[model samples]
Target: MTTLLSVQDLAVARGLRTLEGVSFALAEGQAIILRGPNGLGKTTLLRTLAGLQPVAAGQVVHEPSALAYAGHADGLKSALSVTENLRFWAGVFGRTEVGPAIERMNLSNLAARPAHMLSAGQKRRLGLARLLVTGRKVWLLDEPTVSLDTQSVALFAGVLRDHLGAGGAALIATHIDLGLPEGRILDLTPFRADPARKAPRGDGPVGFNEAFA
Candidate 1:
């Protein structure tokens, strides 16, 4: 696999330090489970990588087109139908169709239903389906299993495994087991209190290009 992203001395904060001195690399097709107690900056890191948050210091080298990042509470618009939301995401990511993303998330039957009409698990699936709209090689996810039932979670794991098999990389932060084959693990709590303050909390950071070792 080739290097997909590189992160060095990353840090995130929220008025106070959330985490610091973080460094890692990521390659294509690898998956790493990021573990940490609440408030260790796990979620913060994912958001920062997604470009949703600002970075304080350090370089995050990456192939620009090869990334997709998602976070918990990324609810679909309640008034919109599943297909509508998917269309919106596809447009945002410049994807042509929502076919594979919908199928992989098991959302075919509910495709026409309004977002608010769906159950918790179904909604989560809809949210995750957005990932498929991007032709990205790197995925940064936070609490990807928040509302998924056991079966749906299993299905998601299967899809995620396939994503890796296809030369994609994933960095997931979750309190639950993700069941990814050949997946590595990282505990973000050890570098917080913000222990090891290197960069500002709640900001910009780099993606890892060789983090799976």
Candidate 2:
């Protein structure tokens, strides 16, 4: 299987060094767990992978046309209605039929509601539903389980499993248990220990922000 994303000797620091020489390779159908304290650069790492943040050191090589990113903010336009939001994302990914994606994400009944009008968990589902439209081989998700009810979370887990089983790759930075049978791990606490290497703030109040483009 091909490596979807690779980081070698990865380091990111503005004032504090949150990750030092952190290296890993993510293959298709595989997932990795990144655990750490508050200040570590787990979010920064995902941003860098998505090419939203500049890498101070090391390298991230990714194949083009095989990337999609979702972060803690939900990234939906508040002014857009649910169907409109799905339409925009569908247009962006060039995907057909908002129907299948909506049904797959359990969002069929709420398609007409405006995003801001929805509850937190509903908003989260709206954000996640984009993944199905994305049609990307590699997914970068930051705290994907946040704001989801037990049932919705389980459904999202099933969705993720199906994505992986289809030869897709994912990197998730999460505190919630994923219930996945297998995943790799890299702790970020050690990197945050350095007082000088503080991480960035903004975009979701101390959480991962996987910005693409």
Candidate 3:
């Protein structure tokens, strides 16, 4: 399979602490589930991979336009309707259609409704749907199943399966079983930075955030 993303000896920073000695490669048609306890820097690692934050060490190799990130925030426009929101993202990705994405997320009935009126789960689904319109081969998702119900989670699994089938890849940070038997798990516990060791200057602090500590 074609390699979609490559990370070598990567170190990700979250505030003062850093997650070091991390490395992984994601290939087309594959899925990797990030596993670790809370405060293990999973979010920081994903943010680093997604280019939302700077890497403290190592490298991430991939096409600039190949990545699509979905974090805790839905990244939505509350004033915009579901269809309008998708259209906006599609346009941003140089696409003009949102029909398929809407249908795939089972948001057809709610397409015309304003985003602010949707439930938490609905918003999460919509956020995930944005991935479809991106046309990006590598998806970097952080807790994608946060507010999804069982059925919605199943629906998302189907969509993900389809994406992989079409040569797309996903690196997801999640705790729940996404029903993907083929998906591999990468535990981050082993990569946690030592609290006593001091990271290099400008590389942030040496220990995890107090909230996680």
Distance from true position, residue 104, model 2, in Å? 1.1
- Rank order (by lDDT, best first): 3, 2, 1
Off by over 4 Å in 1: 193-213
Q: Residues 1-102, candidate 3: write the lDDT tens digits.
A: 889999999877765655889988999899999999988888888777776666888989998799888878887889999999999888888988889999
Which lDDT values do the candidates have, in the order given? 0.77, 0.79, 0.85
Off by over 4 Å in 3: 198-213
Please give the lDDT score at residue 137 for candidate 1. Answer: 78
Candidate 1 overall lDDT versus native: 0.77
lDDT of prediction 2: 0.79
Distance from true location, Cα of 42 in model 3, Å: 0.5
lDDT tens digits by residue: candidate 1, 1-213: 688888898766644567667888888778888987776778777776766667655667888677787776755789999989888878877877888788889889988899999998898889888888877778888888888899998998998898899888999998788777668988887767533444444444444421210
Which model, 2 or 3, shows the larger lDDT?
Answer: 3
Residue pairs with clashing backbones, model 2: 15-196, 15-197, 15-198, 16-196, 16-197, 16-198, 17-197
Note the clash tally of each candidate: 25, 7, 1
- The estimated TM-scores of all candidates read 0.88, 0.87, 0.92
Q: Candidate 1: worst 10 consecutive residues by lDDT?
A: 204-213
Candidate 3 whole-model C-alpha lDDT, 0 to 1: 0.85
